[model samples]
Target: MRICFPVSQEKGWESPVFGHFGSAPAFVIVDTDSGQLEEVTNGDLHHAHGMCQPLKALGGRQVDGVAVGGIGMGALMKLQAQGITVYRAVEGTVKDNLAMLKEGKLPVFSSDWTCAGHGHAGGCAHR
Candidate 1:
């Protein structure tokens, strides 16, 4: 599986997952089968809140799944429609989440778990 992880910066498998999908600075796509890693800059990083174009943010690359800390309803729905499963990322680095994913320990993100908004007192409640 090719899993895409939204990250603030590319640090190979040690990259920490970004809090919000739409606002991530970059993405690290890891090919689970081959252990290859590719970094793609977030193409739509500066879009207004709630106006995230997921494909654009991913630089139009196709991913089998997304492991992210948080995501909005619109973005989550859009990704699902594209046949891309979004998983709720754990609080750790890419390597940590990847292990959980391989063991089927990660939870899939549903509409109920989507982020309400951003810039809250602490962070996104769902995260």
Candidate 2:
């Protein structure tokens, strides 16, 4: 499985996951089968609030799943429409979350978990 993780910077497998999906500065994609990692720049990093274009943010790359600490409802729905399953990530590195994912411990992100707004004092509080 190709699992995508939004990150503030590239730190290989040890990179910490960013708090929000749309506004992350970068993304790390891990190929579970071979443990290969690819870094992608967030193409839509400056999109207006509540108008995130998930595919654009991902630079048009296809991923089987996304592991994020938080996500907006619109972006979540857009990703789901593309058959991509979003997973709620723990407060840890990519390596840590990958382990839980392999063990079937990561939970699927539901609508109720979506961020209400990005105008909060410190960004998305859902994280």
Candidate 3:
């Protein structure tokens, strides 16, 4: 299974994921089966706030799930439509969150918000 994480900073995961999907920087694709990570750096082929051209660039890749700090309704819907589970407003670093996820300590999110990129604002647990 493959998972996607929208990150604010690079830890053990990546740095480019900190950028916007469409206008940010890049995305990190982790292969759970092999524990290999590939950074997709085509900023011109991604979308953040909503489904535009980037999501289309994803083609039919099946994303087992996703965890994003902040996002809007459009992107949320687009992901859902693609059969990709959407977890929103999640907090903590990518590694921290991944640990919690393994222990089933993290909860699946549904609210539309995060570290603020579009019109929404506020993210980070210390916030």
Candidate 4:
């Protein structure tokens, strides 16, 4: 399985994950089979629209899921429309998140949004 995680910096396990899907600084993608990481650096996002630059740049990556702290309604809908499974409420560093995913302990999305302590700058809330 391919998994993407939105994070602040490449801190250790204690570092918490942040940033929304549409407008994240970078995304750490893990290839479950090989445990290799694909780092995607987003240079520009402007909070332009729901289909932000980063997300659009991720086209056809064949990711099975994405782990993030929060996301907006527009981004969520766009990702869902592409059949990409979203898993939110994930806190911890990039490495910890990967381990959690490997252990099947990763938090998957529910009908109710989970967006606490993610610094919801957009203020959309409950992303």
Q: lDDT per residue, candidate 1, 74-118, as tens digits?
A: 999999999999999988899999999989999998788888886
Query: What is each predicted model's overall lDDT from 0 to 1?
Result: 0.90, 0.92, 0.52, 0.63
Instruction: Candidate 1: list runs displaced more than 4 Å.
Output: 120-127
Q: What is the lDDT for 30 in model 1?
A: 97
Cα-based TM-score, every candidate:
0.94, 0.95, 0.64, 0.72
Looking at candidate 2, the ten consecutive residues that score lowest on lDDT are: 118-127
Candidate 3 local lDDT, 37-124, one digit each (tens): 6655434443433454536434444567766554455556667777777554244555555555667665565543422344334222
Off by over 4 Å in 2: 119-122
- Candidate 3, run of 10 with poorest lDDT: 118-127
Error of 4 at 60 (Å): 5.2
Q: Model 2, range 1-127, lDDT digits (tens) per residue?
A: 8999999789999999998999889999999998899999999999988899999998899899999999999999999999999999988999999999999999999999999876646578663
The model with the greater lDDT, 2 or 3, is 2
How accurate locally is residue 73 in candidate 2, as Cα lDDT from 0 to 100?
Answer: 96
Clashes of 1: 0
Better candidate by lDDT, 1 or 4: 1
Clash pairs (backbone) in predicted model 3: 19-25, 20-24, 20-25, 70-114
Distance from true location, Cα of 23 in model 2, Å: 0.8
Judging by TM-score, tell me the better candidate of 2 and 3.
2
